[model samples]
Target: MSEMHELFLTCPKGLEGLLADEAGVLGLAEVRQSTSAIRGRASLETAYRLCLWSRLANRVLLVVSRFAMGNADELYQGVHAVDWADHLAPSGTLAVEFSGHGSGIDNTHFGALKVKDAIVDRLRSASGERPSIDKLNPDLRVHLRLDRGQAVLSLDLSGHSLHQRGYRLQQGAAPLKENLAAAILVRAGWPRIAAEGGALADPMCGVGTFLIEAAMMAADIAPNLARERWGFSAWLGHVPALWRKLHSEAQQRAEAGLTRPPLWIRGYEADPRLIQPARNNIERAGLSAWVKVYQGEVATFEPRPDQNQKGLVVCNPPYGQRLGDEASLLYLYQNLGERLRQGCLNWQAAVFTAAPDLGKRMGIRSHKQYAFWNGALACKLLLIDVVPTQFVTGERTERSHAHEHSDTGQGTAGEHPPAPAPAAPARLSEGGQMFYNRLQKNHRQLAKWARREQVECYRVYDADMPEYAVAVDLYRYWVHVQEYAAPRSIDPEKAQARLFDALAAIPQALGVDPRHVVVKRRERQGGTRQYERQGREGRFLEVSEGGVRLLVNLGDYLDTGLFLDHRPLRLRLQQEAAGKRFLNLFCYTGTATVHAAKGGARSSTSVDLSHTYLDWARRNLSLNGFSDKHRLEQGDGLAWLEENRETFDLIFVDPPTFSNSKRMEGVFDVQRDHVRLIDLAMARLAEGGVLYFSNNFRRFVLDASLLQRYQVEEISASTRPMDFARNDKIHRAWRITAR
Candidate 1:
């Protein structure tokens, strides 16, 4: 009988169980599983086979010696006991890796140094020369592990990690590691599906890792068949004849598998740059006959195979690591789900993502979920059976049912009664029901007024009830909710429960898709914090107010691009701006400038400190076909006004209550700076010109001296819109002209 060698197979976290099962299937004996590794005893042939065939292992280590050690000296003695001449020539190069810390060896580098000294001393005593250190491409690689007062010395047989299958040389920005991709395919049941003659597809294939792994499994090819060098390649104990026999067998099996019917496999990537690289990788794997890749988008992805063929749709969609990434990716996930439903009916799907909440927006139900780790970030694998029964079609309204039955004449007199409406959505709690009723009532009352005025965006509800302190606004078909921070006296858990209830009722009450809703926490912002981005999603939506089209970004900033309460003010500007030179100060998103231009203003100048908002303003003006005559300046409002020498017939000044933006020279307070701000604008006003001043500070008091210097009339009531009437203190406005 041949001697058995102890082996340890390391894999990615959460893949230990799968690795252990794979070891057993490979003829390893007495398999035991630990965190991210599998341990067992195997013959030399079995160990070699595992190194070639393991699709989930990172490295394969073969134990050479084990002994108890109390200190670093004892550790050196244990490694020295091994006959180094049997593994490598005295003049060959070697590398040592040490893990764990104990028995006076607290640093891994120090422990590795001690082991290296021991090995060199033993080999030098036997021969006249000693081996030198080689960190890369060493003739022999040794590993020492110190655990629980014992040391285990092993030889790294797999060398440069088994995950490096050597096919992918060019990769995308964030490519999945090869072994992790293989584990995902295995967990998705690709082996079983392939045996049943089914197809496979990846809609977002980056560099074709999943496609190549799936093709290798379906074609019965060894994962590492093309590798040139291994850790055991230079070892003296390597059995060349046995390895050639196994390699020849693997080659023949691959030939036979290729001769059989080829399974349909395809990959589609949205990035044009990655298409050629993915194709190159697939060709390098020698599976181009069975697999193909193309440059396509997820929105248009469809698997084309023989009729009546069902398969697995596997993809690792980007879940976003930065703040605003999830918001932009929401629509991507939705589009993927829509395509899957329309194109690949009855297909199985496995979607792996780091952001599980975004998965819910796909409008599908996942039957099972498995946890995995992508590097250090925890992720989930959502297993789904794509069928009609699992689609999340929102609650059906009675009107839709009536329209459907009318088309078939099924509800006519004496005919079969119309089918009952779809089942009601899950019941809301008592508090949730109350919140839902309030939202419905508010929407019913405000919707008609909004439509009559051609208003597509307005506030529907605003902290009407103290317990649910949130503001809900309607932006065409989408809803934006801002939750006010609870006071310190309130229980945090209770407040969170109330927030959940409010969120649950919003979609049903407004008749909008839940995915269209965006929520953010509202709190007091200092400095330029309000202008600071809350998310990285640069997605912007174009909305119309008055007669001009403007852009609004609800996901990026604390305040949407357009303020709902300023609708009336913007309309007034449009009504009075014809043929007049206009100047707008502190113009956010340039919505006001767009309105003035639409009102036939001869030309306009808009100024603000943020380059981002200025760019947004440019887009808004361009959207309204008024860009050539407008000027956008990026500087402090006060400084810009001081530098301007031109006169304007109409001016609007809306300053923040308090601003300490880094771009500005000094802090600005609305109450303290009002007098100086009006003076600066009054100097630039043409004869008979008008200036409108406004601010939204709850406790603001206009300087009394302003009334003495100029003829000012308060228009707070007339400028306030109906939606903002409930909050009389939303903003204070005044119309001032020269005395």
Candidate 2:
């Protein structure tokens, strides 16, 4: 019988079993799993096989000698006793690493220093020469791991970290460590997701790391497919023939497992800077053909209009807490909630964030929140239901603007802002399912009503989807209501096709030429834009209310470009815009910009942080021919107001529920900073100026004391438009004037 060789391997914590399993699968002998390690005896072939195939392990160590040691000195003696000259030439370079624990060793560095000293000492004594240390790329590597006073030293058969899988050619801003990424995927049960036809997505897919990794898993591709170097390449016992065979086998298996088109993987980012990086990384990972990266805003991001089946959306948004931008983060999350409720009802989502509280701002109770680490920061990956929101149907009247007075002297221009907001949309339901069911019923009823009454463009939902809280658009044609249902598959092409159908139908329904209807879709509101994609082309931006020709193209934003939920707010702005100096704060793309200008606003000022949105506001204004009269300011909403108190008869203050724009001196969270903001805006108020401060922070509270110097009128009811007349206040748009 052939002789068996003794070997030991090292892996990351919790991965020892995987290595042992690999060894056994490769037909090795006596495989065993230990803490951060795997040990076994095998022919040289088994060692090569383990090196080529094991995915979870870090290094495949070839055991040279095993012995007991009480302390560092004894450890040095055991290592020094090995015949170092036999394997490494006197001219070769060597490196040593130490890990694990021992009370006496004190530090891994000190322990490694001792090991290095012993190896050199032994080599010098035997061959009168010693190999030099080359930590960067050592020819012969040594690993010494000691735990609880026990020591195990082995030859590092794998040279570099196993995670340096050659697939990645470039990295983007803060690319995730490959090992950490694999850990995330494994933690999410990637293997299982792939098997069951489950999907994967990265909302802020900086460089497509997650996307490519997802594709690799779906294709059954080995994580090390792109790696050209292996520790065994330099090991004394390397078997090139065995490695070649193993490589061929992995290739064959991966190829056999690859899935066909309608690839269940996607990625998106609003910045163009990220688009190329994501593509380059995926291409390097050999997943470019299978995975794709799209450019758009988070607020406007949409899945292909046709794709309907739900998958998973995983994202790692910055921790707003570090910068106190929780409010904006909250706004972003609230919008995310809206998007999930509307667009991704059949999907599941996981958001990794350092602040769980920030995650709470999402307004959905996560099913599970897993803890993980990024660098040294503690983070949580919240697992959530990607369906519409379900709220208790009552107590929603808070955000309505009905209570405020809209007496902007001109009736064309509102008095100072309207009174504080009224209640929000009513929760009318319990589970998300119930909310969606009720909405579906409402849509059916509305469609029936529109048909029977022959009302063209009758409202489907006037207020926000408090019950199934998300953005939705319903239009009627020649008085026929158009239906935009989610596609049946997670296929992009199919989804695009469905979108095209909706796109074709919108023009006919809206009483506009087909060319005028810009077709767009959103993955989730306040997300990236699903612009004129390959499947559906053109802009879906024209809207009309009461023949007023309200220009809205949800395709232009993650936010439906219209905020149908905020219909009352726009109407309020419209009624007072004329003849008044209107100020729009956090003016996204400026639907408010357009409304204010066209409503007879004498001169309008729009402030926002995103240049992209500022440009969009410009477009909207120009489209309405209000560009000459309106001025768009590129600055932070809060900071701009702090310095520029230009009071007007009509002022709109809707700072993000939270914001972290660098240009701003500090973070602005509508919840904590509203009072100060209201004060500042009111200070500049032309005595009669009506300051309307609205925010989407669901639980935002007003500092009545802050407004004490002024007459605080509860104008929520008066401010809430007819569309928003149904129930609760999703926002608190108020009116304030000096007493």
Candidate 3:
């Protein structure tokens, strides 16, 4: 090797500039950047320093030879010309990585074999015995890049990609590679943020990649300090004394860095299973004291009051690229925007996502964007300065414009409310005025909280006014109103007047367009009556909950596609679904199955008797790109469980209160067959698996003696969403596990 060798530092695409900048900072000479590699001039010491310090570099390569070649013979001659004795001993083990091809060497394997033969032939001539080949862990690693009839051979100094930082013991779903995580931090300007005494946060921190990387950068810890082995460590030319001196200096610097006030860094995760792993990774990185993680939802995540202000909030939130994934992400992005706008004012925010379109839905326009690649998937890093100017107010959103005029065709109020005291019109009678006031009050009370939670479809008014006698739900830009049937004792004309007043007042009070609102009369439903069609509007509006998009049809059926009360339960299933074989029994519309699939379930089976709903379930699964791994079976839940031979890691059973459908062998009433239903579902549960059984019978009682063999806990309180807090009797749920 020459005194000053030409070296190349490879990194993920779109991170070339940061890698080059890091090389220049490390005092490498003549730094030049490309799409995925950075080239610079470096001595042996410079190369060693970068291997230990460059967080964005994948591997450090020291160029040995470059020659023009058009065929296998020329390639062999070129590699054979280098002095094999200086870099590798004849008795040592070696491996070669051949990439790119030109001339006659069109195959990587063939090219690698040719190069290996040439190296061995040359070494045999010099020492009389060739070196052995060890692909897994060789004493020396060589890389040969062939481009346009030219080949450049180099020695792999860092051994495995430098991105392996030697700390991560375990990882969660679709984890960001360590080097890419560091590159994201560099692009987000974390070093400068730390220098300015500003804190850092990741609301969706999974496995603490971002948090640990940020902490390491802030504390000036060497990226590869903890690595016990390196490619050069076994190389014959390595200088042990020099490496030991440099390693000692790094240790002293880290010790000094640790004494400074720890950076105000924290992370929050919705999945509890990931919290301990995050702490483990942090401890392995020797940064446990500087970083902290907690179990919490994004809706409630906030920076500590004592923490520094004006920092950077970086996160790689779930980017749904599958069929049904996009629709559900709308609310998550919306909620994220709200959290940043409300809590992190003045803090710079960086969100890395594969779907830039979804980022726009956050309502906070990104000031800058940098393209990147997470493996082969193209993505972007969006930067937004969370200042007052970018805040999204209620009036500026689509929901407000939707309510400009009442869709009822009656002359009602427009988008904005009228002056405080105007003459009551015939359309809005005295009773209508009261209903309007009540809706307006509810909207004011729930809108902010709902927005914070990314809840677009929620019950805004649940019979708040006795005269109204209706339940009102806001679904994005549309309103769904279900009026309770008036009692027979009341005068018919008076009841009709009150219903008209309530309908007219909704648009005026909610500021939603009257045309988007759908009205239905609440009635008792049994068997298949609830699924029956009510109108022919043929409109399917999309709303989001727990990062899943659901199709709701207020015009087609009395009940919309979603059961709003189960939002919390669906989210919980999403959290616990990873790597599990999930079974959804009585899966109405298969919304819960979609949640489980999105949560990383290996496979899902949704069983429902209604072919119409089974088809609906298929659509929901198809919407999320989970149609293939999941199945929608049209069969009776109990019968299917009794005949099934497969055991599930997780099972959910949510049966109707009463069903006398002809598809069933007999009437299946929850109150009469509760024990049988639980046992059937539990029978399919695998070891360590759980069965979530639920029904909305309101007064249903469990057969305690029958279920005594299983461990059961009623989770109705935790399963209820914030919107359903007013009515706990909406449903009953229990988590049952085999003893």
Q: Number of the top candidate by TM-score?
A: 1
* Cα lDDT over the full model 1: 0.84
By summed lDDT, which 10 consecutive residues of candidate 1 come out lowest? 400-409
Residues 108-195, candidate 3: write the lDDT tens digits.
9999999999999888854377899998789899999997888989999999889898788888888999999999888888989999
lDDT of 2 by residue, 1-739 (tens): 6457778776665545545765687766788878667788887766766666566567778777767777878988988898886777677788888987674787899999999999888777454777799887887888887767777778887678676677666666666666556656665666677777776767577777778767877787877765776655665556678778878888897777664553567776655776776777777776767787776445444553346555777776755432113223543554455455545666777777776754654556687766665656767777877544531123222221221222211111111211222112222212333433444555566566555544334344322333222223454221111123343545644433333323222322232322222222223222112222122212444556422444444332334445555655676788777789888887876877677776888988888777866776777676666769688888876678777947777887777766555566666667778877777787777856787767766677787686557777666666554434465565666777788
Q: What is the lDDT of every predicted structure here?
A: 0.84, 0.61, 0.81
TM for every model, in the order presented, reads 0.78, 0.51, 0.58
Measured over all alpha carbons after superposition, the RMSD of each candidate to the real structure, in angstroms, is: 7.6, 15.3, 19.3
Clashes of 1: 1
Clash totals in order: 1, 91, 16
Q: State which candidate, 1 or 2, has the greater TM-score.
A: 1
